[model samples]
Target: MPVPELVRPAPPPTRPGLALPRPAAFACTGVLLGLFLVGSTTPSPMYALYQQRWHFSAIVLTEVFAVYAVAILAALLLFGSLSDHVGRRPVLLAAVVVEIVAMAALGFAPNVGWLFAGRVLQGLATGVATSAISGALLDFQPPGSNRGPLVNGVASGVGMAVGSVLAGALVQYAPGPTLTSYLVLIAAFALSLLGVLAMPEPVPHRRPLRDALRPQRPTVPAGRGRTFALLATTMLASWTVGGMFMSLGPSVAKGLVADAPYVVGGLTVAALAGVGGITQLVLSSWSGRRAVRVAAPLMIAGLAGVAASVLVGSAAVFFAAAVVLGVGWGLMFMGGFRMLTGLATPEHRAGTSAMIYVVAYLSASVPSVALGTVSTVFGLTAATLAFAITAAAFSLVAALATLGHR
Candidate 1:
């Protein structure tokens, strides 16, 4: 009997800890990315309401928006690579917690100061999450697939569109408009937190946390200078258009349709962002070079239509122009994102993504503040026209630059 005994085989090793399957994790990460942007733009529809309630000047309103962008920039530069050192789940969890606090601040705000506080907190949370979530997206994407950038572009445009319209509806029809929207966001974010907790760690090899905490300068990947420069130019032009809309599009809508409902203002933003999201989906298979070539002319024409709509006081024209511009915006963003991701390796993915966002938020923030100043001094119409013209000019330059390059 002893001689008949045989050696037992060991069981196969299993991955430690509870985590979602990779496919589910991939989808959840995309939703989380959308949710973060949703939180970021939810306040857009509330700006006019805040100004009406608190009696703040246009400059002050813009300051509120500017503060958020600046906080985002700071967080992006400082904590962008932290997820690469730690894991995606931890960074996302912490950011969501901070976002919940930010939402609470806005939900209960009694004064303009509270608005600033809430926006700053929201910005920090968003900035920190952006690179981490984006990197996680890349990590979870199927092997040999390039769907990550497409997901990023589509999620951002759709999130912004949803946020603007959702907040507008709540503000116009729901009880306690300001408080109610934040309450909904708080609940949504809570659910997202649970999702993050269950998500698997995507970063396989991590560096020490202390080293990754240092501030990082934005850097183009090696030998990617010309491409990076062209992409940066595209970012500057495209995001400037986005910044203007998020900050003042609702107000501009108010001017165009004086008797329109709050939802009309929201729809104005939705037109641009929703259409853009659809365009991204449809054009996902296009090459970056071809996309940009098409984008340049459409952007110029759309901007021109926008200016004319403002002059003629035509809401129809404005909406039409927004649709055209949305297409261009989507193409520009998707193309730039595709090119940028191609330039990055897995190890430096988060850092590389952060660098592009550094360029983006800068364009979004600085020009928005300047446009606000112009609005305060000259009026919203003049400022919008000038902004459109400037954006179109930049788009022209970006297209030419791309064409000249190989």
Candidate 2:
């Protein structure tokens, strides 16, 4: 129940160009969001190290990971649409503050319980920040500028990638995997928080807090279901691979490559996410319309690559598989994102985005958790193979469904 940040009561200055308000605090918007994202999963590579430190089982690793995703989804479900009602800046600042607490808790957390508690706080913070920050990027652009949203998207992608690299390297080489990375993240979060405090308030937002307290449901348009269906279908498959690697791929990597450092495991996951970001940009620029049109086939091949990685059972091959799937994931998401943006009007933009994101992140979360749970009952390898097959099969079915559409 924190009051939003103090804003200049005066209306934002008209900068004429795409520039919105170059509020003193606007410069820090991207920085703050990037830091929040980093804190959310910076510890991915270090989870295996924690397992060794605490002598926990694979089930425990996934459970710990699940806590973070669950917290994030809950926050997004409740607060994802908050920025539309309230201004973006206040929500972002709140998120930064929460990040400070989460990072600190991780730094000094005595046990697994502390990890989940910290992750939940961090998740809540992210839910507040993401929707708000992205909107703020648009809000802050000088009147005629269009580079803001694009830059903002790339910033988010880079933040996610770099955070893992930084955390992974530290976990591999540092004396305190849990403490050092969080300490560094803590400093970054604090700086970003201060910067956000200085941003000019766009307009006074008066929405009741009750707006964000309830869970909303997702629905598809009648005619538009084809687009949404295709988008969601491939998204579910691609995100399953994402969740798989994000949550347990590290452990699998370590088992396969005995010489692999915990950080290397992190790099593998980062590489996948990073490659995904890069692929989206590259494909968008180079592939042109024809490429974008054939989303179904490209995605199927990508899922098949995930299956191949399991069948090969090689770390090197796994990396390659990740790259291929990442490409497919990137393309599918890009097309889907564009379609989602297309389907919704200005009034529905924020809510529609949230709906689509809910679909995307849930597939990434619940399916991965299910896969992990089943992995516990069976062996990791067997469970991975099963998940791989299922994803591949889904891709085939979706490809057929979308075949006539393209």
Each candidate: how many clashes?
A: 0, 14
Q: What is the lDDT of residue 317 in candidate 2?
A: 72
TM-score of each: 0.90, 0.85
Query: Candidate 1's error at 9, in angstroms?
Result: 36
What is each predicted model's overall lDDT from 0 to 1?
0.80, 0.65
Per-residue CA lDDT of model 2 for 147-176, tens digit only, reads 455545455555667777788888878888
Residue-wise C-alpha lDDT for candidate 1, range 1-406, written one tens digit per residue: 0000001112112235767877788899889888887887888888888889999877788788888988988887898778878878889999999999999999899999999999999989988887677677777777667666567767878888898899888888999988888999999999888898888886666789888889876667888777788767888878888888888888888778776457777887788888888898898889877787899899999999999999999988988999999999888766665666667666565567667777777788888889999999999898989899899988887777677544
Score candidate 1 by lDDT.
0.80
* Best candidate, TM-score: 1
Model 1 earns a TM-score of 0.90
Prediction 2 global C-alpha lDDT = 0.65
